[model samples]
Target chain A: MTAPEPAYVAVDWGTSSFRLWLIGRDGDVLAERRSGEGMTTAARTGFAEVLESHLAAVSAPAGLPVLICGMAGAKQGWVEAGYLDTPAALADIPAAAVRIPGAAADIRILPGLAQRDAAAPDVMRGEETQLLGAAAQLGEGDHLVCMPGTHSKWVRLSGGKVAGFSTFMTGELFEAIARNTILSHAIAEAGPISGDNAAFRTAVTRMVANPALATSQLFSVRAGSLIAGLSPVDAKARLSGTLIGLEIAGALSLVAEGTPVALVVSGGLGTLYKDALAAAGISPAVIDADAAVRNGLAAGARALWSL
Target chain B: MTAPEPAYVAVDWGTSSFRLWLIGRDGDVLAERRSGEGMTTAARTGFAEVLESHLAAVSAPAGLPVLICGMAGAKQGWVEAGYLDTPAALADIPAAAVRIPGAAADIRILPGLAQRDAAAPDVMRGEETQLLGAAAQLGEGDHLVCMPGTHSKWVRLSGGKVAGFSTFMTGELFEAIARNTILSHAIAEAGPISGDNAAFRTAVTRMVANPALATSQLFSVRAGSLIAGLSPVDAKARLSGTLIGLEIAGALSLVAEGTPVALVVSGGLGTLYKDALAAAGISPAVIDADAAVRNGLAAGARALWSL
Candidate 1:
């Protein structure tokens, strides 16, 4: 008879989104599900109700093991898994087995990572696991890994551990500046990441070469369009280029110069970075973040089972 | 007769704040008043009521001329002062007087500036006046004027006109990053802006040198505090330095490199720019923004009478 289906589920839950995978005994994903029951909205409907609703569709056995990551393990998550400070390895991740009273599954939440800098102590959730997963795949190399999102992370990986990392509110900054600030009207809703967009490249180079000018440069996007008749689409692209390019230049400085760095980009803006990296004379190894998270969850699950 | 009284009551209204001055024919300040009658909140109480209530304390003639600046002249103001496109001189500023019915005054609002770039068209409101003020002061010089505020403006003054200018959402960016984003807790309420904080200067220089890394470097503030025991105030200062220093570097680029440039800083953060300017090896000719605005109003008023 087929071995009783694996008794565990792995989940990657974040602020505004959630993803889950049903695993069999041998680490096979029997079924996968995604939903809007993210940490932010999970409060309106209780976390248990949200989880039960999503799990109802899955065919996992009663009383299965469920492991979760991301914001779902934060202070406000289904269960708080506390933070594990950095200089951490895979084994350093904390495992908290949370039993949902009268539920069919026992949930284990993974703790996020924290790192102390004598200059500015910092901590992070969710991305630490992704970083761990990426480091595991990369083996050993002095590299700069840029994970672009609402709050982008730039991590330096060396000697099989996270040497140091920094976070930029690049995505959030972009949104606020584009939507909430005065430049909102001049930018288009959407446009090609790269095209006959010389403004984009010029902006990127300008910021990268002279980051100090980033604040003032933003004004030029609107001025160039309004005064010189710059197309709104091109203006938007230029604005994006300026912010992203500045981020790339900033990220590059975290590691040793000429260290043969590889930008392990993971996020929606990964393609943009690939283009930007190319323009800046750097070739990056692009990794699908969703796939990487799945791989990480699987690897994490396997490690939990000591397989 | 008492210098013919003031022809008009000039107002400078802004988001979250408002200020008005009673001016005489000779540009003497008859009286001035300010209130929390900011634009954001004024919507709840009609703009007319706000104006009436604030001016209730001042005794101006019913038919006096009223000139206004700032957000009071925006499209959303009591009456919109349409934008004047750029390559515009002080004389070109549109004077489409806004008439507020049922008021004891003749309101003439000065129009803001708009500029179109063939690639990215944009516009400005109060900043145009600030630029005009800077230009008026410089008289004749190739000047790089840095105006720091919620939205920082770097104007190029050439041939006694606004050659071109750029704006950076640096202050807003800092507020959003520090108060709205994950870095909120990492920063303190306030910090020293003096040279005693070398770490602050270092972080600034680092960011100016490589702006792309801004996102990642933010995490270091937390890490430094948690691991190395950095004081919260110092951490906050470092973050501020990084942002401002980045802006100063960007503002510097509006002029030819190594050119004799004068940085005319007008804002609440003039002292902060003073420190940043010193660090960057530039001399700063600081001006009280309020004083400059008054001077600008006088110039505009004088020009209007002459016309």
Candidate 2:
């Protein structure tokens, strides 16, 4: 347990975030680094340099084989890791990892999942790793996994195989609507929304009952403030609830009745989504998203490098 | 049929627009004026002076009575012409017009309609006047009138009485999502969306079939661009269709199956909505919103003054 010597590096490089962890041979973190130098920034300032700088910061061992996930593998990233099409096996991800060229140390970026159906052609870059990790705890079964973030991913897994998934612009839409639309005036001074807030619960119930009225319900936030004396906090809560609730309804509609749902999330978002799901009478098993991603990277490392 | 002298002025003063028509005793427009001096602008430059300038521009006679509608009657406008609660008669709207006090002329602003139910509190300002105007053509039956704009109002009218309504944040949301969200990248170079576009029609049909997946459908625009090589035009069309379709679905849900639907719209928005409704298996009666507002104002003027 004496920190087992640094064996490999695991990185989750997203759109606007970069996280790197130096993992020991025992599959435990020996050192870690996080920065805003994600794909967008690295693409401008050199992806290889960004990786090298972070590696140097943690005093990594020479020639450490790094396994990366998320946007870093996108077409616009360092090297396009490409996508492993649907009905894909979680076991196949490590094999599809595209290796970065001209690097002294070994570095491989994991492939994303893509649903190539014409009607609902979809793609996910990083969440597939989280899904792989969470699947370990989820075990083999018919499971509905909701990984909430900027682009919330709702995945359906059947017997350790990926069936299909839908990404809801829940978090991003909430920001755009609140800040860019007229709802800004209604929720200008509001603080964060919690699960127990009555407005949040009510909004969730309303969306769940009749999600077709989602946009109409959004306008009610403004009208409620203008005429019905709805408070700013309540207005924000209502907006959050409506978006989250709409997502829940959509995800629920795709899955069969009585199917077990699980929420893989981290930090404050975890509590908020837990409350939102609860509003829809769903109590999903919670999984730490941070740990899930780390565990996913570890699994990839073990599969690839035999660490 | 000799041209009658000007008797009164009818105005539709909205949030960011102002339109005035000097009407003759025979219900003809003697002189018309339009400006950007809506409530928002007039509140800064002076509502009375803006009215005086517009009236002077149109050579309105001295002491000419004026009937106004829209935001000019809001709490922060020229005067607070409070809302007439729902189940209100169109004929009674003129009686409820709050007269501007101490003016040389008899100036009045018509009251908006408010559905004061605690569950779904809603309000409509200027559209009530359009409803008043369109009511003449609508006659005596159940009608679902849709006035599409920044805040699209869907009215449930029965026997010339304002029953209830819902406002969908369709237009505003389209702009917000298109400009502020990641979908912006997908639709950056796209031109305006037309009704006949394949992507637009298909999106409308999808939403009408499954409104709960609205946000997910939104994300598909981006995914479609990335994976399916969807054009920028199609991306924009899909966004527009999803919102329009959602609105139609919500409006249809509130009324009976066979209730006649009408589109009270002006300019390019008319064709888009007509096409959207068609996608929902609805052929709404089209009413020119411009004429509707004028007729509504004239109706109010005739009721208020014995010209």
lDDT of 2 by residue, A8-57 (tens): 99999999999999998788789999999999999999999999999999
DockQ of prediction 1: 0.45
Cα displacement (angstroms), candidate 1, residue A43, comes to: 7.3
Please state the error at residue B283 of candidate 2 in Å: 1.0
C-alpha DockQ of every model: 0.45, 0.84
Q: What's each prediction's clash count?
A: 60, 0
Model 2 misplaced stretches (Cα beyond 4 Å): A1-3, B1-3
Q: Model 1, B45-150: lDDT tens per residue?
A: 8777787766667877666666667777665677787776656666566344455666655666777766554432456677666565656666676777777787
Total clashing pairs in model 1: 60
Q: Summarize candidate 2's per-residue lDDT along B24-73 as a digit string, tens digits.
A: 87888888888899999999999999999999998888999999999999
TM-score winner: 2
